[model samples]
Target chain A: MAGNREFANRRLHSLLGVIPLGIFVIQHLVVNHYATNGVESFNKAANFMGGLPFRIFLETFIIFLPLAYHAIYGIYIAFTAKNNVGRYSYFRNWMFMLQRLTGIITLIFVAWHLWETRIAAARGSDVNFDMMSNILDNPFMVAFYIIGIVSTTFHFANGLWSFAVTWGLTISPRAQRITTYVTMVIFVALSYVGISAILAFV
Target chain B: MAENKNVRFIITRQDNPDSAPYQVEFVLPYRPNMNVISALMEIRRNPVQANGDKTAPITWDMNCLEEVCGACSMVINGKPRQACTALVDQLEQPIRLEPMRTFPVIRDLQVDRSRMFDSLKKVKAWIPIDGTYDLGPGPRMPERKRQWAYELSKCMTCGVCLEACPNVNSSSDYIGPQPLSQVRLFNAHPTGAMNAPERLNAIMGDGGIASCGMSQNCVQSCPKGIPLTTSIAALNRDTTIQSFRNFFGSDR
Candidate 1:
């Protein structure tokens, strides 16, 4: 009974990890796409966001909360997880580790992002759209952004697709397939916009 | 059939998780009675390809050479199976060996399987047994229940169900079948039955049995031949009862 509850608890944590983090990634991507508008326009969005009252306080809480909830709990669950009990496919397994790996990567990416943008701005030298444009113009940053957006989209959409299973939404084979395709479409679409934005800048 | 002198093995190779993957071919001396794992060991020992060029030894995961461990699982031809049990006598020639694409190639054949474990954790797929006191014998399981429950308990966490499960891909949160069977195992136990509602409720909820795609591959692909679909079907009933209990405020 005790063992069961702990396992149950980990699953709950995994569930929690996805909810806030998944929502946050999607919303963040939406805001990030504003960069396609170029420096003045992009910072216009950033400055406007900064202008919102109590925005910093909200940011302060969210900045650390999701990754913390996702990673720590994720590790707890992953450590306790079972292995090789049945025949697993190449696709199923790849998606699994990639999600966790990408989760770690995204966390690191977000922290550095805050350092570059939020922390720098708070110190009176934030890298705004102009600075972002300049930095993004660099091949390294561009590569990072491109890889970041791809994995981020993979993370968010896949999280939702998995969320359906985790949440008991996709029960049948048909539902699973539909869910799979739906997530595929989401990434493909997100990729189109995200990649094209980067390419246009280049 | 004469031991054909011309047999080919195409293998994917990587030095480590950090290294890029590549493929190498080998023309093995067609020994009578060789299995894929034995062949792998041969390649590891020799570290040479068909062209007779020296090559890095290929990396793979294995544990019990017996199929019981389930760690030796990989795609032979197209099916995911234990390399230990996969025999050359039964296989077609020019065997194409690939790491299970369903997993991240840690080096070559060893994929990180933490996700499967996490799914099991998510479902509370264990009998809660905490030992600190000298308690008397636990509740005895009926022979009939134990017979099938033993089967459910046989999950080695091999991940075949995850591979077969369309819902359980790199992108989704579906925990797959092995864990679902575990819930059935624990919930049916007398003392374990105490947490039946909790287990049923968990699987019924997010990443629960409801996430099961019901492809039936889990039943067929299970090396132990555990009746996974049956457990899932039973779970369907159990979760329904749980929902009713929830609706009536009686899910105790």
Candidate 2:
């Protein structure tokens, strides 16, 4: 019974990565593209999402609950696991460490970002183009967003590849090789979309 | 020149399984072609530390002085490998020797490798050719398949891969790389394929292949170069197919 739970946890961990989280990332990138149009357009897009029927229930179930599980469980994995990249500096080994490192950075970045933007907006703060552009006016903050967004996207992309392998979705070497390229494309594409949104603010 | 030269060893020692570990240095007269085992033998004979205090003879396990036995596996110079093949000439001075912590330490450098053996049993890593009499000729395996399978059969239950793997620790139940590779070997055999589903099911459970963090350390640390990660990737696919078969209630 205990063994089954362990197996099931790993299975669920991989499943959740692709489901609400991965889907959320895609939806997020698309929604953020509205930033390129100006604050009013972005607000309209954001308002539609915010004004969903049973918005609290959907956010609680799909966004908050799943994200919390993924983030907390990710931290647990990060803490318990050890890295040997020093002795064995293989590409995959480095990727393994980077994934965990990025997970941590993403956790912090996402928390601060949500609080500064979404939560603040919810509290009746005006999150307009000037506010965002002013926030990115500092060179250091720009650099911070670059690192934060890049790592988060990389974490999600590389994570998807590993998740497939872990769950036995991609088995053959050829299949894994193809999946690597696919995930790399996802990383680059999503990163472009994400970074462009930040750059637009600048 | 021999008298002037001394091979230095920093060995991690523990009096009993429950004892705390401490390091003791020994300076033995240098000998040409000395491996970690030979230096250890000298330490056993002298039973004295560099500080000249007499202590219990160091304890470790070894059978074949060659690397094939995998009995002399330990962490030498911060890397897990077979001590028999680790030559003194290639190593830096004051070489470090420590027990592999992936398993319980039975004594000084000796560790109980029963965890690995138990995993082998759990995965059913053997051809079940029971019963008496001469069973007629078994099905033949293709030469190409046999060739790769031969490479995996080289595992000696050394526990080096286990030691290198971060997931296979006291707190985690990960089965490590050795037995997972063995699953590939046994499943490849012509006769062994009969129980492939059973072995696949074993690995699909907890501490199975899912626990692998993909550190890629085991392949580099393996004395036999058994392609541990490759086996893992292959098993990932096999188990997926197995899972589908299970859902549909068909072994095919």
Best by DockQ: 2
lDDT of each residue in B29-144, candidate 1, tens digit only: 77878899889898888888899999878788899998887787887876777889988989887897877767777887888777778777777777777878876778888999
Minimum summed lDDT over a 10-residue window in model 1 chain A is located at A77-86
The list of candidate 2 runs beyond 4 A from truth reads: A1-3, A47-62, A118-144, A169-185, B132-135
- What does candidate 2's lDDT look like per residue over B199-245, in tens digits? 98899887888788877678878889898888998897787677668
Q: Evaluate all candidate structures by whole-model CA lDDT and list the values in order.
A: 0.70, 0.85
Give the worst 10-residue stretch by lDDT in candidate 1 chain B.
B206-215
Best by TM-score: 2
DockQ values, each candidate? 0.03, 0.55
lDDT measured at residue A72 in model 2 versus the true structure, 0 to 100: 86
- The list of candidate 1 runs beyond 4 A from truth reads A1-9, A38-40, A75-89, A196-202, B1-89, B92-182, B185-195, B198-251
